[model samples]
Target: MLHRFDSFLASRRRFLQVSAGFGVSLMLPALEGRAAERRGAERATSLITLWMNGGPSQLETWDPHPGTVIGGPTRAIDTSVPGLQIAADLPRMAERMKHLSVIRSLTSKEGDHERGTYFVKTGYRPDPTVTHPAIGAVVPYQLGTDHLEIPAYVSLGGGEWPGRGGYLGDQHDAFRIFEPGNSIQNLRARVSDKRQERRLSGLDVVSQTFRAQRQVQAERSLHGQTIDKALRMMSSEQLEAFEVDQESEATLQRYGDSSFGRGCLVARRLIETGVRSVEVTLSGFDSHANNFETQTARCEQLDPAFASLLDDLRERDLYDSTIILCLGEFGRTPRINGLEGRDHWPGGFSCVVGGGGLKSGQVIGATDPEGEQTSPVDPVPVQNLYATILQQLNIDPAEELITPIGRPLAICEGSLIPKLLVDAG
Candidate 1:
């Protein structure tokens, strides 16, 4: 059910293909009514998800069990916060830990890649009965503005399964931007305005005839709105948000020359322009073999970009208004395998959440010295994490949203983790 927008910008030389392709408006009026709820209110305005695609090793990350059998030679370094240490590989992030907090005892049972990804992203297991909207999809659907010229949810470097709109409809699907700083293909038209108008007019006639014959009033309305949204996106003056080149070379270098860095830069720009949610994914953390080597390489890519993003955001005074979340589907096992790698372990993991009015430099929970669950009362489930995120965003996790089929669904079906909030004790 993953949808890609890359080919949607394919050539328009063939009139039939061109005519069939686009819609300018996205009329999800269902979404418009669902403004962010005020319960458990926080003043956050945007979210940037640093999505560690594969399961990252908690031992090598925020919850390193140094000097233990499972520690695996990954030394812990002191962070800005006294007595708090993270993997030595993330030195830059270590210095930035004052704005960050770690939940070291997140637990889940979904180990398979796709299943785990779905659970983490949607706060629900995959269900054939109902395709759930991802957090990214939900935020924009609930908080997006009518006058927004930019797509509310944007994905940078998200591979095949970038999450979907589910019952939210195709309109809420993330606008996937494969190249962070570069312009998206086909955003500008090849033909003159007059020619384009003629083509659209012809398509309108055909659409009207089809609507008259099929009498699919709802479908027609949705389609028309989609077209309108597409059209608006193409001509948006705010489209400059995608241009990271506008940033100075020094700034770009600070974030690093990597795609992930560029993506973070683009994410910041998008947030400044009022995008509700943006996800920047870093792949290759699934270290079933050669765990240390692979993890070190991955951290080399993540540390600079993430640390730079936090610094720049704070420098610009955007930190309080934005939530920066860094996580993966699960975590690597505490035991190193025969191949010197770690297998997937959803039982105990770690995630870093910062800004957005969250209390900083605090560890929420922990694991035993043997890298096992410390207590049944300690583990934070995915649902609770999602609930905390929503609450911090000024959204009510308990508020129900009606699915297209008339079924009521809460924005997030989990209890709030009060310790994660700035105002909480």
Candidate 2:
């Protein structure tokens, strides 16, 4: 859907046939040039996003106002960090609190699922003029693609997928896999390497003619690059990272026996292999009805997996070099509705950020006792969150990338949250 290359070429099945018959492959257009080189010391080498989609409740997750009417039945539990408490459902994550920083008062104006997801992921709201790249897309752009065999960005399961490269082009789109531990389809070459070479040789003549025509060289280039990348990835040893079953049974148990757990494990593997950014989604957080029960269940699923991921990363010495972010488009309301479920509340919410050598074991902001307004602090906008992530990745948040329409847009418009940055060397 991101492109219209099919108009000029036959079906993919036929394109391969023509390549085999002709010799040279037509390349797809390279939309938008690569971002400028990383501007600062890299605080993190990779990013792992645990997307708690469908708008997780702030009260049941990181911002529980225990004993308050707004807190419902969710009780607060002590974390390893003194005086820092979270909802009881995430006891394991509570234990790992020393490795985390919770923003209890994240604020946003967009409450619609589509709009909030876009704002949080791209650091920009939906605009008629230009589509912005997701943080996942921008990270890879700033980091470059020298060592990546698999796509630089990978998305596990569903959700908004962070972003599909937006104006940065589909080249940066996440290589989507619906489930963890499943082999990617079409990865195996149907023909031998020698046969593939022959096919390429066959396509060379046709590609030359296509280039001579110059009617769609950019599109041709884009397609060729995409094919080349896919072919290389099909043969990449790094692809084995997706196989969660290869991990020990005990390790799997530590992460819990759920799809989200498997996804967390796979995320670790992908990050270890140098994938720049990866997002793992755990859906069904929308608790518009039966809010308490739904939130409790979702948090229970999130706890062990999230804790185990932190533990495994630390044991493997990957924790310091990786960042973990957990949040959704927005947070559910503080007031329990007639359905006993909370509605959307973009005014105040919570999110967790840790690792990447960030300052940890701290709470960034707070909401009132009733969980109504972001009290004692200004609201944390979506742009600030994006800026913080980019800063940790060594990408200058102020840098601009030219859009397809030639507009120079800043990667993130917000200033850095000093509390979240690494200590100056």
1-425 per-residue lDDT for model 2 (tens digits): 12322333344446555444333322222213221222223323888888989999988988888888888888999999898889999988888898899998787878898888878877787886777888988897898765556777888886644466778876666666778777765555567778877776665666667767784864734655756665566556677888976888999898878889888988988877667788998998899999999998888779999999898878777778788999899998888999999998888889999988788887888888765454427568878987887888789999989988798999999977878876742
The whole-model C-alpha lDDT of candidate 1 against the native structure comes to 0.78
Scored against the true structure, residue 153 in model 2 reaches a CA lDDT of 83
State the TM-score for model 2.
Answer: 0.87
Q: Model 2, residue 118: displacement in angstroms?
A: 0.2
lDDT (tens digit, per residue) of candidate 1 on 331-352? 9888899999999888878999
Count of residue pairs whose backbone atoms collide, per candidate: 14, 22
